[model samples]
Target: MHEWADFSVEEAGGRTTVVVTGPLLVSTIAYLDDDLRDLEGPVQFVDISAASPIDTVGAWVIYRFAAEHNAEVLGASEQAEVLLEAVEESASTADVAPRRGWFWQRVPAEVGAMVFELGRSMRRNLGFMGAIIAALLMLFRHPGRFRVRALVRQMELVGVTSLPIIGLMSFLVGIVIAQQGAIQLREFGAEIYTINLTGRISLRELGILMTAIMVAGRSGSAFAAQIGTMQLTEEIDAMRTIGVAPVEALVIPRVLAAMLMMPLLGFYAAVTAIIGGAVISQVQLGIPFLTFLSRIQEVVPVTDLWVGLVKAPVFGLIIALSGCYQGMQVRGNAEEVGLRTTRAVVQAIFMVIVLDAFFAVFFTEIGWG
Candidate 1:
């Protein structure tokens, strides 16, 4: 009968009745909540027979007052009764802070959890690799299914466009290596050997290793973010619904691009780095740049170049796989995309470094050291 709720208490024949009236809604509850709380009495019953269109907030207010006064509710309509009961049922205790244990116990638990998750992650990554391999095989069998345009686009993104930055980085790194090596070797009157150090290190390790890291940070993160956005937008699902395989369309091209482009990029990086070292050689070491460049062939063996070339494609494969795998793992929300993108870059770099170490050991054992 009224837009706002109001209550009045009546006493008759040793019984108290708190009569509630009007539309008890969220927008109107505030008008009478303070007044209701101020009343102190042995309230026996809360009569809402005149209350029209009660909302959850109104039901909650009435329920709390009745409970506090040890009074019973009366004349609540079916919907209002259901709302009151639902609010009552929803109440519960929850921890205000995270649970904790003693330091020693907590450390072990955390370590165990980390190890378990790492193992689980490795298994999942292996499964994803297997799936990619199967998809590649299927594409090979049905050559018509392979996406050439996508592959070319990824190659441009992963390799061609990256040349300027990678070249600059390699150039600076080479300069640093030559400059630092000259500083240290000057002590033994072996300054000329800076060429050997610069050539060998750039070709055998830093060139490809740093390139892989760059690709992981750049292309890998981009892959995760792009694919993750597609996933969130349900474009991946749409692809599946329309009989287009996501892996063949999205992942394969990227993988192939990285695999094909890394070798070229690695070689390019090494060449640029040597030019950088040669500049330092001419400027600081008083050796002619062209002479220093020519000396690299004689001082740095063919095996060093082979080492970089061999490792390049494998590193690229790991980086691409990490990116695509983490991207595909995205679900639920936008936050997941960010988390997966970071994971992709971190996972790619970590795997690349680990693989580089393994390759080092393997090559040394095989007489390529």
Candidate 2:
């Protein structure tokens, strides 16, 4: 007989006991209630003395019945326990298989989501660009509402406030560069030309690179944190509801200001770095300040200085765009704001370095480097 084809229940003293006398497979469904309701008993006494032959499916049915009734299966036959253990192990393996597959699928889903977000970001920026053009046209027509105060204040904050730190860092960097060059040049009796090499390299590369990195860390982080805070507080939504454009109020101002200020900052870095190399030349190479300055002036052209300055707006755009994009992606939660702020700074720095490389290669190809 099938282990599950026939079953008997014994009720005594407010308890139920079940025994299997036939095949215990799909046939168990015949007796199962439609709803599988009230299938639980306080204690299930299995009459293992019968030595019923049950398969894996039969054991699964028995386990399910026992669980539904919140009952403990007593008198489990040795064969029944062995069958049930295998069934349980199979179920566990099944569970883990799906989880492993899900982990792999999750990675592709994350990539797809990022691509979707990028498309949405592009649309948002395009809309902002339209509004910017419209505003410029209006400014040309009316020639008013162009507040120079805010512009000046922004320039001062982004440019002047950042100057001292940029100056000091560039100075130290220049000294190190000069010292390194002196060592290598001295070996070839080309020590005097070290000033020219250091000056030209710093003006064309180090000054701009250092300044961009600093701004990415400072201004980009501030933009992200500020916009993220506004997002968490729903200030951005309020502006939209009140007929104010978030881009005009937040993005445009910051982008314009940072772009305007970066060139000035790059200039400051270049000048300070030149001064620094001069100091190093005096101390390390025993060259007078006048001679170092003259050599630097001869090798480093006005165009080299201009090259660093020209790259500033592109770097500033990278910083502002990365920060703004990350900030806009922030969800309305404190943890999300903090996370996006960190992402903004990191992405800005990475993009700046990447753009700097592009600039370096382009300049070299054009005979500027």
TM-scores for all predictions: 0.81, 0.69
lDDT of 2: 0.77
**CA deviation > 4 Å runs, candidate 2:** 1-98, 102-118, 124-143
Which candidate wins on lDDT?
Answer: 1
lDDT of 2 by residue, 1-369 (tens): 432355567888876776656555555545543323454446546554453566676677767666666566666678889987787676542454554447679999889999999999789768656766676565567655454565677667678889889999999988888889899999999989888877887888888889988988888888888888898889999989997667656776677788988888887887788888889889888999988888787887888887888898988888887787677767858999889889988988898888888988988899886
Candidate 1 lDDT at 3 equals 71
Point out where model 1 deviates above 4 Å. Answer: 1-83, 96-98, 101-119
Per model, state how many residue pairs clash: 0, 8
Clashing pairs in 1: none
- The residue pairs in collision within model 2 are 2-22, 2-23, 3-22, 3-23, 3-24, 4-23, 4-24, 40-69
In angstroms, the error of model 2 at 182 is 1.1
Question: Candidate 1 lDDT, tens digit per residue, 1-369?
Answer: 447789899998898999999888988888778888999878999999999899999998998888889899999999989999998897655787878999999999999999999999889878888888899899889999999999999999999999999999999999999999999999999999999999999999999999999999999999999999999999999999999999999999999999999999999999999999999889998999889988998999999999999999999999998899999999999999999999999989999999999999999999999
What are the candidates' C-alpha RMSDs?
4.2, 12.1
Collision count of model 2? 8
User: How many Å off is the CA of 4 in candidate 2?
Assistant: 46
